[model samples]
Target: MEGDGPGGTGPVHVPFGYIVASEKWRGSQLAQGMQGKIKLVFEDDLTSDFYLSNRSCILYVTEADLVAGNGYRKRLVRIRNSSNLQGIVVVEKTQMSEQYFPALQKFTVLDLGMVLLPVTSQMEASCLIVQLVQEQSKEPSKNPFLKKKRALLPLESCLLRTVQQIPGVGKVKAPLLLQKFPSIQQLSNASIPELAQVVGQAVAQQIHTFFTWSG
Candidate 1:
């Protein structure tokens, strides 16, 4: 559980690591968001007792590395993959409040062999950035309602959105199908003819069910 995991092992290195890249920002687009160099600090260990239900693979951050003159620190969580890939860390926490540490810009899992499972979008990540900034500004204990507002959709929404984005969906019909079938798994289970009934034979029949094929 200690050094056996990826990355390595040490006092500060156990569950922590320095940010090598800001996944949310890259090149010119990244520059627009943060004027200074963007670096983050993250955690990759579990805090409490272990269980099958508990997400053994998760990441957190205690602080961030910020550049001077840049009004904001690179306060974002990130995850890393084996193929030199990096992404934002998406963990469900009761409430993350660590604004006290100005130097702590970001909190996430270290670049270990952890793959960031896709469940939400960059838009949701943007909303989280706003919430994290606000939470850091005040005593986290005082605010509870913040938890209710869902910044990111669950796996169901993710699948639904992806399905709707197909070329022929346009805008109107996409929402219609998404509203009816909330998840890819569910949609996949449905018969092709059933989908054709909703989106019509030509379009629906032509669309291959990625989920069914994979399943």
Candidate 2:
């Protein structure tokens, strides 16, 4: 929550869980206007200053901020994981590129959904922020760590571990398979055709044979 910033803006006192606007967004009307209304702070360089819980909700006004370079990208990744926040990067539609897509994927893997907004200006970005704030207010916030911890229930953990051991199944694919079949027992009980429907034929056959041998 602490970072370097210029003086004279005075101490910004926000209620606990208040949104902290990034210093980079000082130019935007929304940021400027909200200065006195909300508890806002200005930080040197951060993924996004306006966050619900740490990095739970971040707003990037430009794609350049995200695709700046390896150092910036790594910092973003760290923030994303540490806060498990929902990230929104605003840019023109034409600005999308293959180079940044991999970084987006990494964000997704951490369960931090990174959204790309093809917005033209701060006006549109501001509107989007209002909408998001409203929506976020409507829903109860869930802790990302608790959600991950819940997934480690004895039975569920064992099932996930067993499923990951299947040939051609890795961390990502194993989760997909679990979505289709909730338990390892059910997955093992499934027919080749049923398993194929979820994970394709070759891998399905491997899973079926592995379970068969174990049985």
Worst 10 residues of 1 by lDDT: 48-57
- Residue-level lDDT of model 1, residues 1-215, one tens digit each, is 13212232222222222122223333432223323322333334422111111112223222232212222213222222222212223422212322322222111111121222222333444343333333323443322212322212222222333455454665567556655554343444567787787788776755544332321
- Give stretches of model 1 more than 4 Å off: 1-41, 44-160, 209-215
| Model 1 lDDT, full chain set | 0.32
TM-scores of the models, in the given order? 0.34, 0.43
lDDT of 2 by residue, 1-215 (tens): 33111231233233343566666677766576554434555555454555543224444535555465444455455544542333444442224444564454334322333333445555555555554544444543242321432232222333454457466886777777767766544666789998888788998888777656621
lDDT of each: 0.32, 0.50
Shift in Å, residue 28, candidate 1 = 12
